[model samples]
Target: EPEVTQTPSHQVTQMGQEVILRCVPISNHLYFYWYRQILGQKVEFLVSFYNNEISEKSEIFDDQFSVERPDGSNFTLKIRSTKLEDSAMYFCANRLRLATDTQYFGPGTRLTVL
Candidate 1:
């Protein structure tokens, strides 16, 4: 079966640099989302995109963050300016629909900022 794949399972970056986390969602899904977990915190939704525009975004998705479908299969999240608090496990997920649908998450990209 197809699955979501994330790159650089762990990443360490400076407090003012940029980082791009990559993901490949399930091949046949139409909806995509990004969520983050700060250590022991709950998974917080960042944004959800479909049909090439943002469907929903949480307060946590500030100007510093952006996402894109660079190609047919690759989805990427870019943080323009990182902060120490930005460190977390970024998970990429996708599902066919929202009503009664379950998201399939990637292994997660752990970002560490110092």
Candidate 2:
């Protein structure tokens, strides 16, 4: 089955450096989203992208955070000046364009900021 792909399944970064997380959503899906799960916590929506632009984003996705779909394939999320609190499992998901479609989640990428 076709599924979203996330690279660097685990990333370790310094507190003040920038980190870019990458994903390739299911090709047939029309909407892409990013979500974060703090260890043992509920998953929180980060941002949603469609038509090559941001459709929605949470308060947590501030100026320091950005998303892009470079080359019309891979979707990327960049976090500038990582903070300890930013360490979490980030998941990439996609949903079909159909009105009642369900979102399929990709294997999460674990981010650890030291």
Candidate 3:
């Protein structure tokens, strides 16, 4: 079966540099989402995209963050400036629909800032 894949399973970055976390979602999936888990916190939704535009986004998706489908299969999330608080596991997920959707997640990109 096809699955979502994320790059650099673990990333260590400086506190002020930019980072682009990459993901390749399932080929036939229609909806894509970005979520982050801070060590002991709940998974927080960042953004959701479909049809090449943002469908929904949470407050966590601020000016420093952006996402794009750079190609047919690759989806990317860019953080303009990282912060120490940005350390977390960033997960990429995809599903077939918005409501009643069952999403599949990548192993996750662990971002470490120092």
Tens digit per residue, CA lDDT, model 3, 1-114: 888999979999999999999999988888899999999999999999998889999998999999999887898999999999999999999997556879999989999999
List model 2 lDDT by residue over 40-98, tens digit each.
99999999999999999999999999999887888889998999999999998989898
Each prediction's RMSD over C-alphas, in Å, is 1.1, 0.8, 1.2
Better of 2 and 3 by TM-score: 2
Per-model lDDT: 0.93, 0.93, 0.93
Q: Which ten contiguous residues of candidate 2 have the minimum total lDDT?
A: 23-32
- Show pairs that collide, candidate 2: none
| C-alpha RMSD between model 2 and the true structure | 0.8
Give lDDT: candidate 2, residue 55: 96
Candidate 1, residues 1-114: lDDT per residue as tens digits?
Answer: 788999989999999999999999998788899999999999999999897788999999999999999886788899999999999999999997656788899999999999
Better of 1 and 2 by lDDT: 1
Model 1 Cα displacement at 21 (Å)? Answer: 0.5
Clashes of 3: 0
